[model samples]
Target: MKIVKAQDFDLRREVEYGSPEQNEAVRKIVADIKKEGDAALLRYTEKFDGMKLEAASLRVTQEELHAAYEQVEPSFVEAISAAADNIRAFHMKQKRNSWMDLQPDGSLLGQVIRPLHRVGVYVPGGKAAYPSSVLMNVIPAQVAGVPEIVMVTPPATGGKAGIDPYILVAAAEAGVNEIYRVGGAQAIAALAYGTESIAPVDKICGPGNIYVALAKREVFGAVDIDSIAGPSEIAVLADDSADPVYVAADLLSQAEHDEMASAILVTPSEQFAKACQAEVQRQLAELPRRDIAGASIEQYGAVILVGTIEEGIEVINRLAPEHFELIVDNPMGYLASIRNAGAIFLGPYSSEPVGDYFAGPNHIIPTNGTARFSSPVEVDDFIKKSSLIYYSKEALLSNGDTIMELARREGLEGHARAIEVRLLKEGKAGANDDNK
Candidate 1:
């Protein structure tokens, strides 16, 4: 790992911008899926996944779910159940109730929250069977009171590794109503367009490969999508007191995810920076995914030895990482200064994996500097809010002239006329600003 002094602009940009191939391939897959539907899906699945499924058996049934339950170890199922409980408990607090506030002029103004009727969730299968993702995606919708929840994952090959049975149980624990043995861009297309085997959904949430991300981007107009997620990222803003071993481990946790994933360390101590670099190499040698992690570190990872803690904060805000770890002595002081981040892990004990697996905060976060704008998946994603306005005859008469004046100023004749027409019915006001 290369240790650079605070002012390395080129390295920062490289870490922030992800691979262009991911974006280009996503576009092609989305276009193919849109034009060809199930046929396109089949071709790509065969091309990428090497799995063949006849048209009729795409959706997984309750019987299969029961069999999935039977397939997994009791301890694994229990762990998923516990994790689901934590996710549910955390998200339930995010539920919003419709409310109306009465104004002094007898008008009513407020907002109503309504859940989307149905939604589709995509879970990556094969070597990456994230049962934690099942909990994170499904539990929030359940909390938001969505009536129907559907899921999609690629089919397991002939008697080979299948979608984790632990994930199936987690789906059950999180109140997911349906599951499909389909994945990739095709699954996203099926959910968006509704083929013979799948039902169209109001929104789609969760994460997947580049093709799936492109599919979501392509189908955005057809159905609501959470976000076009990029590679995973973690930026730890630590001080001299922070543990290099723990920091290195947490950084590697995200780096091992993929070659595109970025793990950065922004610290004030040169000693801490060197210790972290050495620790990452020491830890990487023993990890199962050493090659992947090492490649990620070589390409996207960095350890910047900043002149001061304030400079570290400036760098973090510029990077706008998806996951941020504050390992300083006073985390709360810096928390207020943090302007952008999808989710923040405070203190030494609050590591990234806690949020990824057991902690209640949804692990589905913004990536590749999108944290400056996008947010983590929450109950609000599955629900919509509508502002409600009501004006009684008295309230309208009082505010009518002002409303008409604004409309006339904007040259909206019809808007002015609509107010005049309402006022005329009551015979108490005119189209002038001074009703006083």
Candidate 2:
């Protein structure tokens, strides 16, 4: 990691997000799936993942789900259950109810909240196991009363023909009834447009690699997506009272995610900056994913020196990191100063992994500075709201002219005419000359 002055660094330096070729490839994949359906799904599975399958065999069977339990230890089942309980409890607090208000003029105004009928959740598989994500994606939808949650993962793992048992176990524990053995851009397309075996979904959630991200962007209108997520990131705000070891460990946690992942430390003390740079080097030597983390640190990681803690916060807000840690003298006092982070961790004990695995908060967060506008996945992502309105005769008689007047100001004759027709039917208001 390089050390630099805050004024000398550009916080929004462009990282390796994706390429045009990848976007074109994803577009073609989505088009093929939309047109060819199951046939295209099978072809892409064999081409990208080397997994051959029949149309009937795409969905995981009850036997497979049961055997997934046997493959894992009893302790894993207990842990998943506990994590699921925590996640469920946290999201239950975000649940909403459909409500209607009775007006004085006998009008009914309301917002009807209904959980989506079916949703598709993408979990990255094919030699990667992140069962925690399964819980994060499904729990909020379940709390919002969604009836069906379909999960998709890569068909093969380490040259084998099955997903990781832990992923299957997590899904089963989370009450996911439907599971499909497809992945990548093809899987996203299949979910959006629906293959013969898989039905179409209202939305897609969870995270994936570059190809999956591009595919979601391509299919956004066809099917709603959680968010177009980018690489994981962390920005830690520290002072002279901060611990260098803890700061370095937290930074490496995100750096190991990808070469494009950014890990930054903003501090007021130059001594702490140098100490953290050296600590990151010492810790990187022992990490299993050292090569990837080293590349990330060399390319994107930095220790920036600011004049004061307030200046450090300004730098942090400009970057708008996916994760922010305030390892300062009084962490809670600085909480309100943070304006643009996907998640906030205060003090030394609240490590990034606590939110990633347990602690009841959804780990799926906005990346690539999108936290400035977007938010983490919650019950709202799995549901839709329909605004309800009922206009009484008395209400229309009192308000029709004002509505027509506003519509005529916007030059929307058709809108004004519709209101005029209603007013005429109710014998409330006069007709406009254009309509006559």
Candidate 3:
């Protein structure tokens, strides 16, 4: 890992917008799916996923869901169920009811909160199966009362014949039944524009490869997408009191995610920074994904030297990392200073994986410095809010002139006239009265 002064370090990573070829390819796939529907869907599925199937086999069967349990261990099921409960409980607190506020003027103004009618969660199904991701994406939608939660994965995982049993088990545990055996950009297209078999969804969520991300971007206006997530990131702000071993391990936790993942340590003490860098080297050699982690550490990982803990925090806020760990003498004291981070892990014991797997917060976090403005996937992502406006005759009559003035200022005569027509008809009955 490179050790650089705070002033010397450039924290921004070059955003991946996909190559021109990839973008053109995605556009073609999306357009074909839109034009051809099921025939196009199946043809692309076979061409990409190498699975030849009819439209009848598009949806996963109930027997497949039940049989998935048999493939997974009883212990695995127990653990996932517990994790699901934790996730569901945490999100349940985020649930909000549709409310109306009644004013003295007999006006009803508020928000009508309602869950999306249907949502599609795209689960990546290649070398690794993200059962935890299935839980993270599906549970929140369930908590938000999304009636139909559809899941789409590649027909095969790790070049195998069927979807990962663990992913299927996780989906079942999270209360999702509608699933399909498809993947890549085509799957995103299918979700956005309905096929003969798969119905269109209100939104799409979950992680995928470059193709999937680009597809989500292409189909965005047609259906809402959670986010076009970037590579994983973790920034650790530590003091001399922090353990080098713990700090190195936590940093590597994110680095091992991929070659593009970023892991950085911001500290004031040069001695501690050197210690953590050496520890990261030692841990990286022992990791199963050492090559991937090593690349990430070589390119993106760093130990940033700062003048003080406050300066380190300033660097952190500038980075706006996806995951942040504060390992200091008093982590709580610094919590208020942290203005940007998708998920925060305070102290030594609170590792990032705790939130990623079981601690209840969604791991589908905004990435690539997006935490500065966006947030991690929450219950709100699966729900929509419609503003409630019930202006009484008196309320409209009292406010119509102000509304018209604002509208006219914006040169919207039609908008002003719409309110003018109402006031002209109703203003005859004591328009000057303060109360109805």
Candidate 4:
């Protein structure tokens, strides 16, 4: 990790995320899946995941889901149930109802809110498994009233044949019935385009590696995808009043996620910056995942020194990090001025992992400076909105001439004529087919 002044840093030019090979590979996989369906998907699974499968065997059996519960401890089951309750309680607050407004003209105008018919959640497998991700992804969709929620995880973890038991149990507990033994870009393709076994979903949500991110970008129009999240990154905004040990531990929390993950600290106190730098090095030695965390810290970690907490806020907004922690004298006082963070944790106790696991907020957040324009995945992501406009004879007669004028001004004579038809029928316009 390096300690540097903010004036010397250019965060935007530091890194280039996805590679051409990754994009090309994903493109080829998505194309093959679209063309060959089950056959292409099966081939990819065998080639990439080392799992040979048939169309009939792709979907996880109910027996597997039930048996998964037995493999895990009772305490684990209790924990998952509690997490689900918290997640459901939080997202249920975001649920919306279809609403209409009646006009004085006896016309109706409203917005119709409806959940997606089906949704797909992709859970990463292999070296790391996040059953927490399964809960975060499915709970919001379930809250939004999505009837069909399907989950796709890789075929194996720790070189075993079946998906991780924890992930399976989490899915079963979260009310996800349809589970598929597939992953990576092929899993994304199967979700976007239906196969013989797994049906297409209206939207896909969850985080993955670069290949999965690129696949989501490619299949965007075929099915709605949550934002393309990059490597997990965290920016801690602290002042002299902050704890250096607490700051260092929270920074490494995101760093341990991936070698590409970034952990940075922004503080106005020079003493605090040096203290955190030393604390980070000391703590890095004790981590079991020291290699991964150290690599991430070496590659992407930094302590940025600024003149004041106000300047630190400017730097935070510029970075627009996925997760932000404010450890200052009064965290809430700075909230109005702080703009660009996927999730803001106030005070030292509001550590990043708290939000990652037990906290109800979605851990699947916008990453790599995308928080400037994007948002965390929520219940709204699982639903679609339709505008409703019902015009009555009285309403049309009152506003037809103005509507016709605007349409004709845009040279859309057909649009004007459509409005003129009703006006003419009601004796509100001159006898002419043209809107003029």
Candidate 5:
């Protein structure tokens, strides 16, 4: 890694990421699926996922789920179950209550909070089996009191047969009501517009490939979508006291995620920066995905040598990273200063995977620079709130004259007369007063 003066490193431009062409492809698929329905979905699924299944078999049955449990290791299933407990417990804190307040006048006003009737969570299976993702996406919906949650993954083919058994086991633990072995744009379309088999969902959550994101965009008006997630990212702000090895390892953790993934390190210590550079090289030699990590680092990574720790923090704030790790001394002191970040990991012990797995915080974080405005997946995503208002007869009577005056001022005679008629019926107004 080459050390760069802070001025030479660009932060604003680096934040903008994702493929525009992919967005276009998603639009086309969504439009066709809307017009052609299941037939269009089948064509896309077969073309993209290389699986051709009848629409009837899209849903995974209990028998298939049992087989999945049998296939996965018992220890893996148990671990997922344990993680589910933590995820559910954490999200339960985010649960909202329906509230109403009765006025002194005979009127009640408040908000009603209700869970979405149904939701669909997409799990990416084209590259890897994200059992962790299954847990993260499903647990929050369940905690939010969503009645039905469905999961979809690209169908396993050849010797591969279905959604990963580990993913299935996690889904089972996370309270997912149904699992579908379908993937890509087609899956998004199927969830948006009900097919012969798949029920239309009120909302769709979870991360996916570019095609999946495009499909979600196309279906926006028809169904709510959590967000169009981009490639993963991590930014580490450290000082001389921060361990170079730890910094290098954390940077590599995100770099290995994808070629487009970004791993940035900002430090005030030139000596520490060089040490981290060396440490990254030493560790990269042993990493399983070194090629991917190396490419990501070469293309998207940066090591900025700032003149001061405050500058490092400023750079991080400007980046608004998806994952922000503070490996500096007094990490907590700077927590409030960080206004933008999908998740913050303080101290070396709090590794990225901690939040990704056992920690109750949702791992579905904002990607690219979206953390500047968006937030991580939480129970709030599955619930909606409506405001309420009411007025008593006495309250209406007291305000009726002013209300009619405003309505008549607006030239809405009908509106004014409506209130006048009510007042007359209650004998509150003179019948001959014909202002009615």
Candidate 6:
């Protein structure tokens, strides 16, 4: 890793919008699925995933789900179950109930919160198959009371015609019985538009390759999507008090995820920056995925030198990293200064992987500077909110004239008349009731 002055380093990275050829290919795939439904889904699955399947074999059977348990160790099951409990407990606090506020004028105004009917979670197959992702995506929807949680993955794992057993076990543990063997853009289309075998979902969540990301973008308005996620990122803001080994390790955790992933360190001390830079190179050589992590660190990683800790924070806000670590003498002292991180780890012990797996926060965080405007996946992603309005006769009559005046000012006579007609009829009824 090269150490550079913070002001001299360019923070901008070109966003991946997919090549024109890839975009055109995804458009064709999505259009085919929308038009032909199940046939297109099957054809694309066979063409891309190399699995020829009838509609009957699309859904994973309950027996298969149970058999997945035998394949995985009891230790894995116990760990996942404990993590599930922590996830459920943490998200339950975010759950909200429908509420109505009654006014003195006998009017009601509030919000009605309801869970989505169905949701689709895409778990990538092969090397990207992560059981932790299944728990992260499904558990939140479950906590939000989503009734039908559907999962889809590639049919082949390691060139075989079957899903990963670990993925199956995780889905079963998360209470998702509806699992499908499909992947790539075709799977995203199937989830959004629905085929003969799989019902359409109200929302889609999870991470995937470029094709899957493009498919989600294409079908966004047709169904809700979590986000078109970018590669992982981690930025550590530390001083001389921090451990170079710990900081270097945390940065590599994200760098290993993808060659495009970024890992950087912003520090006030030049000596500390040099230490971390040397430590990272030493650790990178020993990493199992050194090729991937080494590529990321070589291309996107940096050790930025700042004049002060406050200056370091300003640099962090500009980058808006997906994961941030504050490892200083007083991490909490600078807590309020951080405004753009997707997830913040305050101390040396609160490693990023802790939150990624067992800490109960969703690991599906925004990346590529998206943390400036977005957030990690949470319970709110699976629920929709509708405003509630119940106006009594008195309440409507009291505000009717004002409402009509505003509506007519906008040249909406129909909207003005909607209030005018109600006011006129209610006025007459009130007069008659008073006379009686």
**Local accuracy of candidate 6 as per-residue lDDT tens digits, 319-402:** 999999999989999999999999999999999999989988888999989999999999999999999999998888888777
Off by over 4 Å in 6: 158-161, 428-436
Model 3 spans > 4 angstroms off: 408-413, 423-436
lDDT of 4 by residue, 1-436 (tens): 8989999977782444478888889999999999899999999999999989888999999999899988999999999899889988999999999999999999999999999999999999844899999999999998999999999988996256488989999999999989999999999999999888889999998888778889999999999999777888999999888999999999999999988899999988888899999999999999998999999999999999999999999999999999999999989999999899999999989999999988799889988788989988999999999999998888888888888888888989899888888777776763333545
Instruction: Rate residue 39 of model 5 by lDDT.
Output: 85
TM-score: the better of candidates 1 and 4: 4
Which number leads on lDDT? 3
Kindly report which residue stretches of model 1 are placed more than 4 angstroms away from their true locations once superposed: 9-47, 157-161, 432-436
Clashes of each: 1, 0, 0, 0, 0, 0
Q: Residue 133: error of model 6 in Å?
A: 0.7
lDDT per prediction?
0.84, 0.90, 0.92, 0.90, 0.84, 0.91
Global Cα lDDT for candidate 1: 0.84
lDDT by residue (367-400, candidate 1, tens digit) is 8787888889999999999999997888888888
Per-residue accuracy of model 3 over 303-389 as CA lDDT, tens digit each: 999999999999999999999999998899989999999999999999888998999988999899999999989999999999999
Worst 10-residue lDDT window, candidate 5: 10-19
Best by TM-score: 4
| Per-residue lDDT of candidate 2, residues 1-436 (tens digit) | 9899999998776654479888888899999999999999999999998878999999999999998888899999999999999999999999999999999999999999999999999999732579999999999999999998999999874238488889999999999979999999999999998989899998999889889988998899988999878788999999888889999999999999888789999998999999999999999999999999999999999999999999999898888899999999889998888899999999999999999988898999988888888889999988899999998888888888888888898889888888888888876656455533
Descending-TM-score candidate ranking: 4, 6, 2, 3, 5, 1
Q: Please give the RMSD to the true structure for each candidate, in Å.
A: 2.9, 1.8, 2.9, 1.6, 2.7, 3.2
